[model samples]
Target: MAKQAVIYKTEAGEREILRRYEEILAGWPVPAGRHHVPTREGDTFVLVSGPEDAPPLVLLHGSGSNAAMWAGDVAAWARHFRVHAVDMIGEPGLSARSRPPLDSTAYADWLDDVLDHFGLDSAAFTGASLGGWLALDYAIRRPRRVDRLAVLCPGGVGRQKFGFLFKVALYRPFGAWGLRRSIKAVAGVDPGDTPEVADYLTLMFTHFQPRRDRLPVFSDEALRGLAMPVKVIVGARDAMFDSAETARRVENTVPHAEVTVLPDVAHSIIGQTQPIMDFLTR
Candidate 1:
């Protein structure tokens, strides 16, 4: 038999990571509903919160993360808009393990099915890292379907940095201690500050295989075509992407875009719950 493809380093690792994921979900702050939406790629998991009658807002987490990433912001966001936090396929979530080509339209098609399932013609979007790239891709391809766009340290808009790989490699030999340091360097946050979060990330990186391909950069013409309101929040100290370039490109092409560069922040942007809500509700 041909070797089976898997995302986690081992089956046991998958179980442990998912077990912890479920634990986080069990403590979800607000009244939330979880379900799977059928798509061409596979079954997509969605965590729904907020009032059914409120305007729809979709949340996308960064790579190596799931819907639980929004646990801190959901309660505030859910109060105003109906929030649908989606687990991107192929990630370490309950979603399908289908890894499609980034250059292809497969992701957009899957999203189309997801929106259709929710009976939504258009909705606001908030995405981080790889999720940010997905949101930009969808908005560029299906502009009419995006009511508004918000991204945090998003890829595609700026050049992706490869220096972090060397840092990761240098720490690989150090075992768990080195892994934590590497995570801190890449994430721009001290993992030790939050033991629970640090533990989860360490567990995830130890097993999960992150994507290696470079994120496709958005062309100036494509960005200029985005008519919906756009907001981009990136950290100045980001080790993964060129934040200055990202700010410059967005400001030049997407004139209406609101760009905020946090002076001392890094790839892991935290404490933006109110700012994002203000953008969505405004």
Candidate 2:
């Protein structure tokens, strides 16, 4: 008997996913300089954009998404800051598919390695969904490295209801239809709007084997320990977690935190270009 692989079903499946991933990257609004930075965990891939002398801003995407997801937001963000969009090590990106446990501090150390590779002492950090949780974790573990923080639909700050996990469990049986429903439930939008997005995500869902480790909740002590400016925004319609509860927790826990609940927005947040820029530049 042998252990089964989890990241990709087959070598051909991996190739096809990588091909689509490159195609998506090719369509980014701005040209990005790709770099493979060495870390103790593995080689981390990052897409670099914006001016060289500008302040550094790191972008982290949600689970199942790569750096290319920032295509729409990169142009405006690049104007004021040098952006580095990272591909999480264990996700469906070009980075190493070897996933560290979600509950461990390996991700924080990996992020530290990335920053050190870039020679950045401190920088403003922005992340969405799981990315947000990683950013918050790093800020908590290595407070001195994060100058400011902005999170969209971040996890770990508050509890993730069991219902979210239950919805995910239903994705396999429901197929594309189930996936669409799950997306709408969490993202507040139909995935079919964009042909490429739909195709790419569909392929990922069908072929990519994402990590199954449950995300851990952050302690109140960790949240209270953050001294840097923190801005948290959650969608009003987010079904994955209670946005109101998250906002309340952050606002109550962190002295310099500001929480905003956007009307009609879901877990997949949008229309945040100016607001995030304002926060990072201010």
Which one is best on TM-score?
Answer: 1
Q: How large is the C-alpha RMSD of every model relative to the true structure? A: 2.0, 2.8
Clashing pairs in 2: none
Per-residue lDDT of model 1, residues 183-281, tens digit only: 898887686577777788899999998887788898999999999999999999999999999999999999999999999999989899999989988
**For model 1, what is the alpha-carbon lDDT of residue 85?**
98
lDDT value for model 1: 0.92
lDDT digits (tens) for residues 63-129 of candidate 2: 8888877888899999988999999887788777667777888888889999999999989999999
Q: Deviation in angstroms for 50 in model 1?
A: 0.6
lDDT of each: 0.92, 0.83
Model 2 lowest lDDT segment of ten: 1-10
